[model samples]
Target: MLFNLSRPPTALRRSTSEFLQLCRQLPSARRALYVTSRSKTMSEPKVISVEGLSSSEANVSGSLRNAPRVHPPALMASVAILALLRSESNKFPPSTIIIEQYRPPVDRHVVGLISEGESPEQTAIRELEEETGFKASGVVQSSPLLVSDPGMTNANMKLVTVDVPFPENLEMPAQKLDPGEFIQVRIVELAKLRAELQAYERKGFVIDAKLDHLASGFELAEKLRQPKSST
Candidate 1:
């Protein structure tokens, strides 16, 4: 089933923060959140806390579940796509950019949230189709775990690309965005991206944000910089 792509209730902030503070240590913990810990000795169930942080996720999940407007899917894997394109003007690239989420009521990055039974790759393709409304073929895969903004949430994201020609076949119903996903996508060329790394407006910035998350971002970005063969 498609995961509930909604915001956690306001009350859960304290809990989320507490748990993340702990699990931020382990390497896998970067993308995965703390779930539970099995208590060794007990007639009662063992206490589980965030993997690293002093607190665990179960407590938060239980509390959040009982809270008003709070649903399940307490911890979920969020997958996303990165689209690259070659414009008509130049054989090379002006740049590759990830489309920002369409926002109104709430604000979120544009990512393909994987369903419970679905694969991350599927989520990537499905999300791209819905968000961009452009039926793309051939999705190149990369390492799945992502950590652009590690300080905020322990969100597990992925990077994938579907190339398309630019200069205007891009038709997307920007108005019909998943609720809460606000976006400010910029189709920045390599020169600009290189010129202003720090100053780049991260209105849901895609490529550079997850600098550490992606070992390949720099390498791939370089390929985009080179002029493509016209053959």
Candidate 2:
């Protein structure tokens, strides 16, 4: 872009006195300032040309002060950071389920186990015999299994449960049970299972997954206990 300046008088070169006088009247500053009287705006030094210079020789200089800079969103970078933060830890929680098998369609008086190798449900039935000598009338569908102490212990166990009808009293076949292993057989009422869960939670005991599932099936035993609900 060429700037138009008033033509210089042909006597310009010899008039050093006049140029020096003009320079003395101009103020010097860190940044050159150009005032546009037409728009009342301040701008950077722009075009400059010698009055006698041809348009081809004119100079156009623009201020490099301002130009907007844009950047990409940081979320992409943060999402990528998750991979670096992933843990190298192997610590894992234990899992197990506690079960009590019932006899037929009765209370949730489920069977428990005494040893391993027997299907966990088998242990439940065996415990029924050892504790009360009652054969599990039948097995429930898909009883829960768990690592009761996923955090601290290695007891990977499952609990199988069934409903047991009340006989004259809880009876154990002495021959089938390791009499030395079991000390007591207590009959917990259907109403007490929820309290039992609360107790386990208070103690920070992980409910055996097997028992958790069993509990779901056995839910509303109290409702079952209501005489009106029964057929």
Candidate 3:
């Protein structure tokens, strides 16, 4: 006796025929078809329903349910410039850094985002000049990218340090700010950064984590620069 294999349903056959016709239009479709066929052949049949499953299988299902879900694209690239500006004063230090006080959508804070088609260093230089009206020499240090908040976002920040020269006779340029931006550039002493940050925090301004890290880095660098006294 001869036996015939069951044929696929008409709808499935039609769908397959249409898919094949569409695939024929593309050159790489044959490779895709081969991969799909191989995958399907290698894959084991999975029982989706929890009913009548073994304890191990049920546990596996539960684990799958608790698995971290892959979120959509919410990652963003940001830049924070720790700008050092020259001060022409004998009493005070010869240089002071600039930090901005700006409001974000959630709260009044300080941070900056890098623009498209611009490097981190470029973004820092541009933002520093735009916010403070000072053109400065910039250097992109070998610093690791920091995650703003690992739990909430995949956003990473690039911290850049820019040094600006302010000679007594040097002309200051006009600030080029965006229409919606309301930024106040404050000259901050590196030694008094903690106090300054505290003062800002008292005024309902939320400090960006990147700024805190940058400040800490500055302090550490200063400490390293201090000469050790010989015993």
Candidate 4:
């Protein structure tokens, strides 16, 4: 479900000094505020003060029946596509044309958040076209929602793969990025994806977790395909 972040109530408001004093007063697990939809505006947020409960019990679940848990109004989810194109030039050894891009803050794959009524596949196709100007009829594969950082946030993403035909003439495709999107596209060879990621990191670019894991998967597959040495 989608959620809109709003300010907390005035009663719950506490200054930095007041909060520090409260922490000193409470000698139990840190106090946490869990957002819940109490009404239309979601104004009724429950403050779960686990001053007596143990660390594990602090995180409420259905098992508790009455325990209150933090449920954000909206979940952070997106679709990340691994768009691959087969080049006609190197049909012998097989070449996978991986479309990547670099923007401020990080180097990431073609990704975007899923709109209110759009499916994951639709998000992938739209993002692929919008970010790289490459159109796909549909995705080749769509994986389940993969959590990017469960410990930090409820943010997750669906990994999708789309296969598009690389232009035989090897012409660079144009991007149709929205305003404020200064994305620099890079066509990295699949065989050297791992190396390219390392090189990108060396240049002080923060690599997205999805892209890093994808490159590592390729490297692992390559090693698995290699023949073992004789004993």
Please give the CA lDDT of all the candidate structures. Answer: 0.44, 0.32, 0.50, 0.55
Across residues 1-231, which tens digit of lDDT does each residue of candidate 2 receive? 000111112322313355335434544220012121122242532211112222222476433222211221221100000000011242222111222211221111223323334454455555555444445565554323444443332233343434443333333244243321212222333334456665745744444343344345556664686688466
**lDDT computed for candidate 4:** 0.55
* Candidate 1 per-residue C-alpha lDDT over 165-202 given as tens digits, one digit per residue, 9 for 90 to 100: 65644333343345323333345454444443444233
111 in model 4: Cα distance from truth in Å?
Answer: 2.0
Report the Cα RMSD per candidate. 14.3, 39.1, 21.9, 13.7
Candidate 2 stretches greater than 4 Å from native? 1-117, 166-176, 192-231
Structural similarity to truth (TM-score) of each candidate:
0.45, 0.31, 0.53, 0.62
Highest TM-score model number: 4
Clashing pairs in 4: none
Q: Best candidate per lDDT, number?
A: 4
Lowest summed lDDT window (length 10), candidate 1? 1-10
| Clash counts for the predictions, in order | 9, 31, 0, 0
The TM-score measured for candidate 4 stands at: 0.62
State candidate 3's TM-score. 0.53
* Full ranking by TM-score: 4, 3, 1, 2
Per-residue lDDT of 1-231 in model 3, one digit per residue for the tens? Answer: 000111122222224346446445645312122111111231422211122222356446432221111231233366666666555643345344444432212211233555567777887777777766877676736256776555443446666766766545334466676643344455666677767777866754566665566567767998899999999
